[model samples]
Structures are given as C-alpha cells and as structure tokens.
Target: MPPVERRDPEPIEAYLFDLDGVLRVWDGADLAAVEARAGLPPGRLGEIAHDLDRYGPALLGEVTDNDWRASVVGALVADGLKPDVAVDVVLDWSANLGRVDPEVTEVVAGIRAAGGQVALVVNSTDRLELDLVVLGLDLAVDTVVSSARTGIALPDAAMYEIAAGILAVPAPRCAYVGPHAELVAGAERIGMTGHLFDGVSGLRAIVETLSAR
Candidate 1:
C-alpha cells in the first residue's frame, strides 16, 4: 500500500523476489485442480492444507519432508482411498508445482541486461532448486536464497541478510518485492526497499524505470 521506493531519487542497485506470490506461483495445484487429480470431492485437500496445526510445521520445515507427506497421505487414506492411490496423488501434486509469471521473468531479464543484480529470496522447502527448474525462470535471476536449504524463513532478519549477502549487495541498496505485506515488512525492517505486488503492469513499469536509471 506504500509508495514504490523504486520511484525514489536514490537509485535501486539490486532487486530481490519472493517465490509464491511474485515469481513462481503454485496455481498448478489449487484445491479444485487437486481434487480432480486425487478423485476426491472438492474441499478435501483445502481442508487439510489450511489445517495450520497439522501441516504448518512441515511447510515451515519444523517437520521432516516425509512427515509432511505422511500427514497428507493419512488424511487421504482416512477418507477411504488406498495408500498407493493417495501417495500417487500427493506426489503428483507436490511434483507439478507452478509456472513462472512471464512478466516477472521479463523484468528480471531486463534488469540483468541493464547490469542490475537480481536474486530470488524465498522461504520454502528443499525443493527450491527443482521448483526453479520447473518454472524455468531460474535463468531470470542471478542467484537464489531458499529457506528450505538456508534454514531461514521470512520475517526473520537472517533470511533477508542471507539473500543480500548472496547478491553481494547491502540490504538498503536492494528492492524487495513480495505479495504479502508482512513479508515485505520483513525486508523493510532490514533497510531494503520493500514493494508489494500490484500486478505486472505496475511492476513492469517500475522495473523498466529502475533499469532505465
């Protein structure tokens, strides 16, 4: 909701992105689509995923990856599906992931062309590399900082510090973009310019203007 700091007189020397909302989206497996794939009625997967108490730890890496899958499988099997079938559905859903936003891809590439540094700063599981490969937008940014591998998550100062360190840019010199206000707030807390995603139209214009500078 705040003004885009990319418009500030101080030139933004680098850019960083969040995973789920900004660049790589998990739209490939929304509740409706997963229901069709798992042959379960709508709202089943939704109920489980939104169950913060059960699956939240897995998502935040508090639980092991296997434990997370087991939790999902147990829920599916309890609903009368066979173990093998549940496993297949869960695996399929997990593996497919999401597609890259082309606008973000273009903006990142444009930043690179203009000699700006770009990085992917995300809090996710160890599948970060594979996720990037699937989205095929790893080519857009110069580096990535994934919490699954880094053992850090957003709203944590360490996560932002690690990303800025990897990019070899000071936090104040980097512009952080994400969908969540809280997550962007984390970056801002570290003195990075934080921008909430409004859509590609606004983001592209900012990207272009910054690169032009």
Candidate 2:
C-alpha cells in the first residue's frame, strides 16, 4: 500500500485508535509455544477463538469472557483433546495479551502533547479492562470505548460516537486509526477523518500532520 498522507481538511481535536492491530503487537512465538504444548496445529486455537458465530456474542456483551473461553475449550475438547488439557491450553493462549508497540505509544503521547485527546475504541470482550491493565495501557488514552461495554461494535457509528462524546469532542473533529477498511469507512461515515492503519509510518505521517496543524 502507498504511504498515508496528511489530508484532514479540518483540525482534529481527538483521535480514536483501534486496540488490537494498531496498539497491541502479538508475538507468534508465544502462540507457537502454546500450540506445541497443546499438540494442536499452529493457528488452530486462534481460529477457534475468533470464529465469528462463537465470538460475536462475547463482543456484543451478551456473554462473559469466561463463557467465550469455555466455548473455545469445549471446541478443542470435542476435537479429541482431554477436557482438562483443553482448558489448560485455552488458559495459556488467552493469557498472552501481547506487547504494546512503542512507536504507537510515542504517537499517542505526541497527540496528547499537541492538545489532542485519544480514545481506544475496540471490539472486545469483558476481559478488555483486565487485559489493558496487564499491558499497562489502562491509562494510556483519554478514554476507551469497548464493544463489550457499549453493546455496540464497529463498523456501527455509535462506537465512534461514544468515544467522541467521552472526549467532549464533535465527531467531525475526531480522527480515527484502524486496520480494517470497513471500520475506517464507518468512522468516515460519521464525519470523522479516517486513516487506515497500514503501518507505523502511515500512522506517524497522520500524527505529524495533526501536530503541524
């Protein structure tokens, strides 16, 4: 993809960041280790955990995090692993929340330093708060809007709307960074400037633009 340019027509007062791909960086080796211990093929556990039909309710706040994990474990058990072994494997896999990206951290700090607020907007489960605390990101932003907490997820406009409202900023004055094109488009539909987060450099470019304003 080409580099993202600084193209916001209006001054942005706040930034809405996506949690998983934008701020948190996953380590494949950790996953590989967990899969090895479980005698499962690489990516199998993740595939099961992210299966939309099984995970949709969790993200929508209809189920607890424990319920989601239990469902994944049950699926593994049905695939021939002993129930106890499956539970252990799921626990280990779920514990790895991944590390924060320092570059993105710098960008977030820069935005705040420039008088802009930042909110973490995510499609997540009830475990989000715990995971944020574990990753030392609970205080990293001005506010957080989780689908599990709001009972709404992107590309629904309400998620972005709630984040902007929390920051006391108008939707048109907020900028969004996310990996999914659909989510980015959703934010744009609500009048927020949207930057598709293809990489750190693209995000940095957007930050630079916002800072220079």
lDDT of 1 at 74: 87
Please list the residue runs of candidate 1 whose C-alpha ends up more than 4 Å from where it truly belongs after superposition: 1-9, 28-30, 37-41, 53-56, 59-67, 209-213
Residue-wise lDDT of candidate 1 within 1-213, one digit each (tens)? 998766555577889888787776666347467679768887777677547786556646677666777788888898788999888878876766766777777777878887888888877666667767766866768888876666667879898888788878888788888999998899999888788997888888777665555
Runs of candidate 2 with Cα error greater than 4 angstroms are 1-8
Clashing pairs in 2: none
For candidate 1, the TM-score is: 0.83
Error of 2 at 10 (Å): 1.8
Cα lDDT of candidate 2 equals 0.92
